[model samples]
Target: MQFTDEDLGAWVARQRWYAGKSHVPRFRILDVQPAPGATRYLLMDDAGAVPALYNVPLALVDAPSEGDAVVSRTADGYLIDAARHAAFAVGMLAEMGVDVGRVTGSRVLSGEQSNTSIVFEEDGHPTIILKLFRTLHHGENPDVTVQRALSDAGSPYVPRFLGSLDAEWPDSGRESGVARGTLGFAQDFLPGVKDGWAVALDAAGERRDFTDAARDLGTALAGVHAALGASLGTVDAGPEQVASTGLTWRRRLATAAAEVPAVADRLSAIDAVYQAALERPWPQLQRIHGDLHLGQVLAVQDGGWRVVDFEGEPLRPMPERAIPDLPPRD
Candidate 1:
């Protein structure tokens, strides 16, 4: 059975992870990959300034459940958002080729800004979290590889990487007319943990000394950097890389000036500093959490610190995200 792009356009716009929310999407179904109990739809959305691809997995049921909306009527069942069902988690595990015991339960995490993540349960207890990538690309997702590397290294700074799913599809842009990309990833769920940002905020609000916590966080970050360097290795910042990075500085200055006219007044002063930085010696760059911040760290009670989301800037191209970078969080 097949469905049209129009079947998903309106529904996609309502999704939290949809980028072009302002405009109704023009969806074009690219490929359909049948999983255990779901069908993964690869779509190209042409409603934005540029065409964007997305991965949407769906399932059909006999009747609409609590939050299910009947996308269409079919003789067998009604098409619904498969990610909301437990079977979707089963299919997701099947898709990722992982065996984390029989999935006893499944629930979507709230306040997801990008990908659709579902917490899966085993033996009637929650355990694994699978993130379905909303935006599609044709390459290795660093979020999987970097974390996987650290996890394999027995690093305590990150959760254990369960597995990841990837698929190949037609793409005329590539020389082979085919491309491969990650679909989703599953990781062990860290239960009863708090974000460093919240803890810091509370400490600040209460006027409590946070030196110990801050030191622990710095240690954890250093451990993460060390693990990444050992796993991925580092390279000297060559002339070309430095020049490219300097160009990025100028670009940032331009953006800052444009965004705040007041910043334009001090543009020359900023440029002078940037010029000085360009002429200075540069350190070896390595794989890093390109988008690191306080919010990305977790404070595990009785534990040190744990970092998550190794994938670089979400806005950067996938391949670029995999590149070795400065720890300064570009």
Candidate 2:
């Protein structure tokens, strides 16, 4: 089955994970890779101010059932979102070479931003969360690299890395059949754990003292930083690196000022703060979670915390995300 650019653009615009939601995207198919039970398309969007890339994996079925995950109806069959289909989800796990024993069930997790996550459950084996990378990059993703490194370093703060999926493709304007991209990642899932954000909110509502938990969380984060630095190694922030970072800050501020009317009023003050910060001696830049917050963590029953989602800011470019930089912005 095949789809036109217009059809894909319309479907992409309706998806919650799509970055360019305000305008209709002009699509260009970079490559197509066949998965176990689906077809993955590497696409480039030229609609926004900057061109962006994405991965759209689709499953073709002869007919739609009552609970079918159909995205569109084609002449030959119904197009389904593979990430949301149980069979496709299981196939993905097999592709990743994950030995989950006997897979009993699978379901798509909600509240994901840039990628689709499917949770596979089995009786004996540990539950697994398979994250399908929506945005396609040329090489290794920091999420996969960082987690594997930390897990190999014996870090208990992160989930155990199971396996991954990648594809070779022929990219235009480049050497044919040399380009490869990360398709998805699989990791152990901690069941019965609550998100840090929810835990914090509940504690606040109950007027419970969370100072100790906060302190422990801080300690764990520090340990994670130490592990990442030890494994990946770090470099001193040279003058050129500092200058480039400063420029990024300024560009981000300018973009915010244009998009948010309220920011325009304090642009001068923001610029002043940025300049002042730039003048100070920069800290050694190393691999860290590029996007960190309460929500990116989980609280276990034993008063322990597990950090998840090493994928950097979804809107940032892949190359920039892979490079070591300042600590997570939030």
Q: State the C-alpha lDDT per candidate.
A: 0.83, 0.83
State the weakest 10-residue window (summed lDDT) of model 1. 67-76
- Which residues of candidate 1, in runs, are more than 4 Å off? 22-24, 73-75
Alpha carbon deviation, residue 287, candidate 1 (Å): 1.1
Question: Model 1, range 1-330, lDDT digits (tens) per residue?
Answer: 556778776677777898887776788888888865778888888777867888887888888888664566667778887788667767778667788467777888888888988898777777888888888888878889898999999999898998998898889889999999888898888888889889999999999999999998888888999999899999999999889888877887898899998999999999899889878998889999988888888988677888998778876767777778787552
Q: Pick the candidate with the highest TM-score.
A: 1
Instruction: Write down the RMSD of all candidates, one decimal each.
Output: 1.8, 2.6
What local lDDT score does residue 161 receive in model 1, on the 0 to 100 scale?
A: 93
* Model 2 C-alpha lDDT per residue in residues 2-101, reported as the tens digit of each score: 5776676677777878888778788877667787688777778977897778888888888876665566788889987778766778888887888755
lDDT of 1 at 303: 77
Candidate 2 has its poorest 10 consecutive residues by lDDT at 169-178
